[model samples]
Target: MSVIDDAIVWLNDPLNWTNPDGIISRTGEHLWISAAAVALGCAVAWPLGVWMGHVGRGGAAVVTVTNLSRAVPTVALLTIFPLTAIGFGPKAIILALSLFAIPPLLANAYLGVREVDPEVRDAGRGMGLSAWQLLRKVELPLAVPYLANGFRIAAVQVVATATLAAFVNGGGLGMIISRGFGLGLASGGGQVLAGGMLVALLCLTIEGVLALIEKALLPKSLRRVKHRPPASVADALPAGS
Candidate 1:
């Protein structure tokens, strides 16, 4: 049968849809776990990133640590989690993906804050703005685009990496793929491919929605065209001087 036909069959399969045992329940559970991990990662990373960027201190250290955390193989890390201690299910995968998420979130937060123009900051300070006031009124508004971008990236990563949960026997769409692969569907792994495709589509949809949100959140001024200064003499002439 064609791939589409195979996918339809797989989708209609009663065995695939029903939450028999806790295994079937894992799909929803894993998605929840991944979301929680992303949320937790954002909570920790965003503030630290914003602070580092605003203060212009410890950014390199933060980046280094985040990078190092990202570099750790997630599967290996998941494996290292003591099954005896934590058992299986969502905890191990959440820990794994949370670490995976931190680098991008932190990096983006730092980049967002750092990207704010010094002139704007100086103007805020000159207007008698306190540090917190400056952050709230000036830096944060400017940094939001980059921050949102970071969130988008982190969100996609979380969705994709969520599949790794299956290795630990934690559920999600990965369970579908895993089971399909093991069963070797009549269409030659088409079921697994279909399951994987569903995940890809979900990620794409999430990214598109987030991009729209980022666009909405950013100011029109920031969204406007950024033109380079004209060359030399003509550009230097004052408008009315």
Candidate 2:
């Protein structure tokens, strides 16, 4: 049979679709685990990022640590975790993905805050704004765009790295690829290729959705700043004159 025909057969097979020990079910669980991990990572990273940016301290340390974490291979980390822990599953995958997410979030947030114009900050001070008020009203508003961009990046990374979770016997599209590889070894290579293709398609779809969200969430004023005219000489004259 042709490779396409074999893939079609495997995809349509009832065994693959069944939730229990089925490819589809396992993949869904994997996605959920990755999503949860990304959520948790964001929770931990965002506040720390904001605080670091506000204080203008520990930015370098945080970035260095996160970069180091991301540099560690996910598969190697997953493999090592099982040695420490009895089972390999969602927890391992979550830890791995969370480690992967920190650098981008922290770096972007720091850069975002740092990029806020000094003149604007000076203006806020001149207007009798406190440090906290300046940060909230001036800095954060300017930084929001960069913060959102960081989140968009993190989301994509989580989705892509999620497939690796399958290697640890964790669920997701990785399960399909793993199963396909096993079947290929036992029989032929058709199923492996098909499963890998499906995962790629899923990643592409996720990326497109995130891109749309980033565009929608970005501030319109940041994209196009409207300039107000200076006060007129007529208006400057006394009201009773």
lDDT of 2 by residue, 50-70 (tens): 778877887557645754664
Q: For each of the candidates, give the backbone clash count.
A: 1, 2
TM-score to true structure, per model: 0.81, 0.82
Please list the residue runs of candidate 1 whose C-alpha ends up more than 4 Å from where it truly belongs after superposition.
Answer: 2-4, 18-27, 82-87, 185-188, 224-241
**Clashing residue pairs, backbone N/CA/C < 3 A, model 1:** 27-172
lDDT of 1 at 138: 94
Tell me how far the alpha carbon of residue 122 in candidate 1 is from the true structure, in angstroms, after superposition. 1.0
Give the lDDT of residue 181 in candidate 2.
82
Q: Write the per-residue lDDT of candidate 1 for residues 113-155, one digit (tens) a residue.
A: 8878899999999999999999999998887766666777788
